[model samples]
Target: MQETAYAKINLALHVRSRREDGYHELETLFAFVDRGDTLLAKRAEQDQLQVVGEFGGALDDPFGNIVMQALGSLPRPDGLAITLEKSLPVAAGLGGGSADAGALFRLVERAQGLPDDWRQRAAKLGADVPACVESVTCVGRGTGTDLEPIDSDLTGTPVLLVNPRVPLATGPVFKAWDDKDRGPMPEGTAREIAEAGRNDLRDPAISQCPVIAEVLAALGKSEAWKVEMSGSGATCFALFNDVEARDAAARAMPSDWWQMAGLLR
Candidate 1:
């Protein structure tokens, strides 16, 4: 089976508090984008993984990759070969790795006829894995594991994702968060969540990578839409009401930056 593991951008993020486990409690509105990595899995005589693609060259340690981690958790079949065609930037807060892991789990479930409880297994890999499995907008809480499904009707909304090409480490961004206390859930429906606008990590992320501030400024300069940073840093996005506006904004973006304008799937 083959499937695309879509990347996600945080529409709104609020850090509530620091847990005793050293993980931060957070409330965020998550939405999957149409752009991301691709995975192809086929049953084999033994369990194995072969990764290849544009970003594939960067993965030296296959064991450390979430695809391997997730596949390892499943019952070993006679054999299996999986290939990851990576598109999302690594460690860019776009949940690229997490999505790949989720896709692997789904492939295993389908090929092995496993039970539906694999989503819990996906969560064990990362907080974003579960949502990536669903690949839709959701409200995530409690270290980003708990998920409440939101409407999936973002057909008309166009989002332009801009990665400054600077890799930002998530650990440092969370470490720099000033308030560890959790906050009340933002009011209103999913639409409100998307339009309300917030990213708890934006300030700390900018502190970690000053170029992110410049990315935001550039996004703001465009009259196409509302802009916000996703997850930790380095990757910012703008939401436009329509594709025409989004295309105009994409054209206005600097040539040096890595940019993708597409509808939220």
Candidate 2:
């Protein structure tokens, strides 16, 4: 079986409260984009995984991956060989790891009856895993596991994603957050999902990785409808009403930064 591990982009993330457990309570709008990694699975004599693509080599240990951990959580798992096309930037606040893990979780559940406590299982893998499993626009809260599906349609919304080759780890971004101004959620039709959007993590993330500021600055000047950092840092996006305008903006973007333009998926 094969599945696309679409990148999870935070339309708006507001850090609300930090718990005694060190988990931050947040309110954010999550959306999946067409541009991301892909996964393929096939039954094999022994379980294995091979990584490839732009950021494949970023992982230090392939066999001891989250995919393997997902399989281990299954009951009497059979041998399977998996291939991951790591197209998305690793540790760049794209939720690449959680997307991969969620895809595998679905694969195992489809082949074998899913566990009763699937949400809990997904949450165990990572805070974003449950959201990734849903694979749609959701209001994420409570360390990002409490998901409430919402109506969203970016149909012809053009998007240009620009990532300065720097990876911003989530830990530092949270640590740098002032934990103030945990704003209210955005409200609007599906077409204008981010009309009231705000990302509290943006400033802190930019503080951690200064290059991210440069990216946002470039995107801001593009004359797009709106431009903001997606999750934490590095990967900032400019939204346009149409593809023609988005493509033109992409063409004008810096060549050194990673750039891709497509309709919001």
Supply candidate 1's per-residue lDDT for 58.
73
Per-residue accuracy of model 2 over 1-265 as CA lDDT, tens digit each: 9887877888888888878999888888888777678889999887889999988889759767787777666664578799998888888777889989888877776677677888898889889999887678788888899998787777456788889989888888899988686667767765465866788888898788888888888887776887889887779888887777888888887898887676666
Stretches of candidate 2 off by over 4 Å are 190-193
Worst 10 residues of 1 by lDDT: 180-189
The alpha-carbon lDDT assigned to residue 13 of candidate 2 equals: 85
Per-residue lDDT over 146-170 for candidate 1, one digit per residue giving the tens place of the 0 to 100 score: 9887765564578899998888889
Name the lDDT of candidate 1.
0.81
TM-score to native of every candidate shown: 0.93, 0.94
Clash pairs, candidate 2, are none
